[model samples]
Target: MTMEKLIRFAALAFFSIAPMAVATAQDSADYHVTVTLNWTEAAFPVGFPEDPHFSRFIGMTHNERFTLFADGQTASTGLGLVATNGRVSILKAELGEMTRRKRIGSVVEADALKAGAGVVQMTATLTSAHNRFSFATMVAPSPDWITGASGIVLNPDGPWLESLTLPLWVWDAGVDGGQTFTSPDDPLPVKESVRLAATPYFLHPAGLLPIGTVVFVRVR
Candidate 1:
């Protein structure tokens, strides 16, 4: 075979299961790949506003870089930011799975998702190894949630990663545990909870908090 033809074949065969001829090597090579992902949302029964409820969005960011909770360690700052925002209840994910791959883009498709609702439709497209891949997730008996079949793409020369979003449960900084939502005048506006003057607020958990959810990885 001529040098030009051999180069062309190598470019097209990166993900191929075909055996390679070690003797016939090329100067430089590149490959392409893609992926399609689907996601859904589900919330534990928090009930009506008169009974208030909450949910979460578990995502694997570009290259799956880092994660919040470790097996025996504490949650970090980035994750803490998410948790604070989700006040009522939400899993703050750090990140995980920082691969050699790049982030082309991701998509989130859904009709509508209610706070306490179980399901919301979503989909994503990812590019890797000069090719494209797709997957979806679906939870049974719940329109509020759905996940597609995951098409995994692993690298013989790449990395492994994981990240997650956990369930939401009510929390109140202990100093003012019994405080209700209200208005207070100061240099800054009063936030979510009411004031119990002359007291300090601390971490105090309430309600049924959710367990951690896993972020699935795709191997090419």
Candidate 2:
């Protein structure tokens, strides 16, 4: 078979076996992690917990392996996932708490939230083998505009691979005119215009915010 097909088949096989693989290696796994974050959006009719504002982010980070956002590039794949699905979810987990919750994605189109911006919940999932893996999703409002790694399974990080997977977010794939969000003409984050061609990467912890964004991918 072709190389691309081979890779896809191999990934499916690995996922099929992942249950046992995970059980056996649960303890020895390189990283054991849990992420929890809360967000508030003025776009919502109310406030935190009850108000149900803007968006949410659900992703995973491995030992310096992956990130929801890419760097050097602009924008995020997560956001693209939102607009396409029109709905997603971000699950909040508490260590040993046995409780999980989901929330909405972003609303970059909202006029009220345009100036104030929006708040987003975040969760992350990471793998020990590759820098890529399928990411989680959050759904609430329509026009979903944020998401994280999805079915991500990158090959082991060599010095070069490690160097690439630094802080970053998701972006529209241009599959459906990526940069065409909200309007037919210029996209909101005009600076991100170049990002329409490929997936973006940013090393900033706060993600792309306040315009004039900078993307840096760092390994930790």
Off by over 4 Å in 2: 1-54, 58-81, 89-165, 178-181, 184-220
> What is the per-residue lDDT of model 2 for residues 83-153, given as tens digits with 9 covering 90 to 100?
44433331222201211221112111211122223333222223343333333333223222343343333
TM-score of 1: 0.30
User: Which residues of candidate 1, in runs, are more than 4 Å off?
Assistant: 1-58, 61-65, 87-113, 124-220
The candidate scoring highest on lDDT is 2
Which candidate's TM-score is highest?
1
Model 2 weakest lDDT span, ten residues long: 95-104
Query: How far off is residue 120 in model 2, in Å?
Result: 6.1
Candidate 2 TM-score versus the reference? 0.29
lDDT of all predictions: 0.28, 0.32
Residue 53: error of model 2 in Å? 8.6
How many residue pairs clash (N, CA or C atoms closer than 3 angstroms) in each of the candidate models, in the order given?
A: 43, 50
| lDDT of model number 2 | 0.32
RMSD of 1: 12.7
Residue 96 in candidate 2, Cα distance off native in Å: 25
lDDT by residue for model 1 over 1-220, one digit each (tens)?
9999999899778636334453122211222222222121322322212322223333332333332232223333333323333221222211221233343123232332233334343333333331222222212112112222122333323332222222322222122122322212121122232111121111224533332122333321
